[model samples]
Target: MGHDLDVLAARFGRHYPRWLLALLIISTMTMVLSSTSINVALPAIMQDFAIGRPLAQWLVTGVLAAMTSGLLLSSWAQARFGPRATLLTSFGLFLVTSLVAPFVTSIWALIAIRIVQGLCAGIAQPLSMVLIFRTYPGEGRGMALGLFGLGAMMAPALGPTLAGFLVDHFGWRAVFWLPAPVCILSLVGGALLLPTLRSLTPPRLDVPGFILLNLALFGILAALAEAQRFGWLHDATLLTGAVGLLGLAAFLWRCTHHSAPLLPLRLWRNASFRHTSWVSMVLGVSLFGVTYLVPLYVQTVEGYSASDAGLLLLPTGLVLGVAVFAGGWLSDKLAARWLLVGGLGLLTLSTAGQALMGTGASFWAICAWASLGRLGIGGIMPGVSTAAVQDLPAEELAPATGTISFMRQLGGALGINLLTFFIEWRHVAEGASAAGDAQAFVQSFWLLTALFALALWPAWLLRSKR
Candidate 1:
């Protein structure tokens, strides 16, 4: 019921060190930039291995899958190891992986290393939100996430630009090299800047439930990732998918009965948290799907450089920054319900416009529609973030934020991989190649628009506490 950060800050006094916050932001930016820096490197990766779209796509899916599985362990790790120790350990893992990734000869080896990198990277993702939850108050949570966003959002647009340049001039290895220093810096920052609040009362670990839920989530996502590569109609694919689904159902059912379940059924028991989380998931799906698809269209279809594709995305990123800040600031004062609705609606419209693009449509039109749809995402990002943090019990804030972030990551992983598959399938079904089929690109947007519509229900159903 009480404001968490205001209370903590008041206790720390006005002189609470600012560099700690700086470290958090810097570390977050570096970690994110490293992760995304690969988008532009995909072409190089494919060429190096002489692989196809599905295998190259797995480089991303594998990392996301690792992160998804890793999130389930964050709370437990933090509780046992403490925040700084956990963060530093994760950074160490990331540093090692990044340094080694570029030297591998085989695509399978690169992916194998990436899977390790994903587990390492996963540690940072949840803790960033958890830190803000622990350190900031209800009204202040928006400020924290906004500040966090400011530090990280640029990487999505910049990573490819930097990677493209690095690959064009130096090598793909340079792209991996870029983040290595950042990871070291994060380790240094984690040592000094991260807060040192020892867990006062650790939650009991539900080990059995944790294993069941984690395996189920891992199975389903892995199946989704592999489905596109292996024919979906194949007997093994159908059998594994059915088992994965059943496992997922069982995991959800078991969570309800466990005393301290991994997800905590109670978090979703809240009217707003439940709705907003679904919105977050749908938004994640739509956002990642588009992020992957658009860049590919520009670079592969239209034959632009990765740097240029990133530049094309600049307007959208800038507007997204504006929308996120505005939404967060307004969350405390305005009715967030309509804001959520309008955001999703605008997103749908923009995606719809993208779907109508012909083979020879104006290049600028791609930029316009992409920017428009993403602004909607920007508007909702902070609001959806605010929704859960605002109503939560002070103690549960960390877990809640971590869980929401995990959902977004999972959605991104699932959306991008699956949509890539869908785009290929639809093209093949039409007796076409994805490279030249403008209609295939349009069909890809159909899935994204449908996802935006799915987001609408959650945004509409979620009631603002204000």
Candidate 2:
């Protein structure tokens, strides 16, 4: 099978790298689409399952937690099984799980399937990065990554609108089945075109490190998830958060001492790696937090239907998709630092605009500001990611990519929790009036704006030149 794939890739390699990139982008977009599209469906799911906001949120958090855990295993999987085999296996699992998800009657069952789907997505995500880096030449690597980011970025951008339509017209189950055709195409492409690239020295799996990382991530997420319900200073929240912090400290210590840590401590030795990781975390916060909050706000506070809420982001997503490609192309020729700074600035402005948005604000005005923020995100993503590992050796690239991706997912999970906590806290304090809900959302947006501003300091630390 490996030999056959190699020959086939060579045959296709004759046409141009674009075809291979198309396959990868489609595969990756399916996973990303799966991730973001569900946000719009959460309310519908809540209605169907007769659950409250907190339980409904697990649909998002569970997938993120599962994806984060799956990311830790990706480098090892690629090293042990080789890229083509890993891609084929993961893609197949994703397709099967997504197909099965819509049929599950129980909410717990659906969440379980979502986690499995997230695991498959988590494996594919980092591998896609490695594949792009390997397939494209060094000079053109940014352009390749940019194209890949375009697909990944666009999925979230457009996914909600599509999901809203499906959920509104066909029911929430339709959202689960939306990615099937794309996944099928991606599966076929992976079998034929994905290269059989394997690490010569596969790293040992650090089972203890994996466990500690999950304990930390899951604990922190759970703490944040329940903080609003239990009170921020409640013993339960404090204990869970403390345990998570200790687990994180232990995980870091283990990485420093272990011969083959799950996440190599040495990756941080590079200045670029350190800065880019911080930027990626902030990017994740903005990206995922906004995606989660916008639809909920529009539907609940502003009285828009799910479809209308989803459509509000359509222009922003389209702008982001285009900007990502341009950002990638320019990163190859310009200083990444400028791009980072500029992108963060736009993100800050856009987020702040959202924070200041009045209940009576025009829909187009909201779209315009959000599109500006998405544009900024588009500029920062490709440049920051490319810069993160651009200086590392080939052997270190896989783990570096995995680490970066992990941080982003971690940030996303935490960001959603943080925003939710703030929203709930404010809503309770301000009283449950419709105006109060709007106020809570506005306050949460302010918090996000502050995060984007804080990210700029690290973005400035990024190396100016490639």
Which candidate comes out best when scored by TM-score? 2
For residues 1-466, what per-residue lDDT tens digits would candidate 1 score against the true structure? 0223444456557544344566677776666666566776777778888886777877777777677767788777777777777888888887887898878888888888777777766777667767776666465665666678776665565666677788777877788787788788888756645665557787777777766765666566656656766787776567667767877787788888876777777788788888888877877775566767777776666777767765676676676777777767766676667777888998899889988775555668988988887778776776777776767788978678777877887788878777778877777776776543556777888878888887888788776567
lDDT of each residue in 343-433, candidate 2, tens digit only: 9999899879988876768789888988898889877887677778877888987678778888888888778877777887788789977
Among all windows of 10 consecutive residues in model 2, the one with the lowest summed lDDT is 1-10
Residue 391 C-alpha lDDT in model 2: 76
Clashing pairs in 1: 5-136, 5-137
* Model 2 C-alpha RMSD to native: 2.8
Q: What TM-scores do the predictions have?
A: 0.87, 0.90
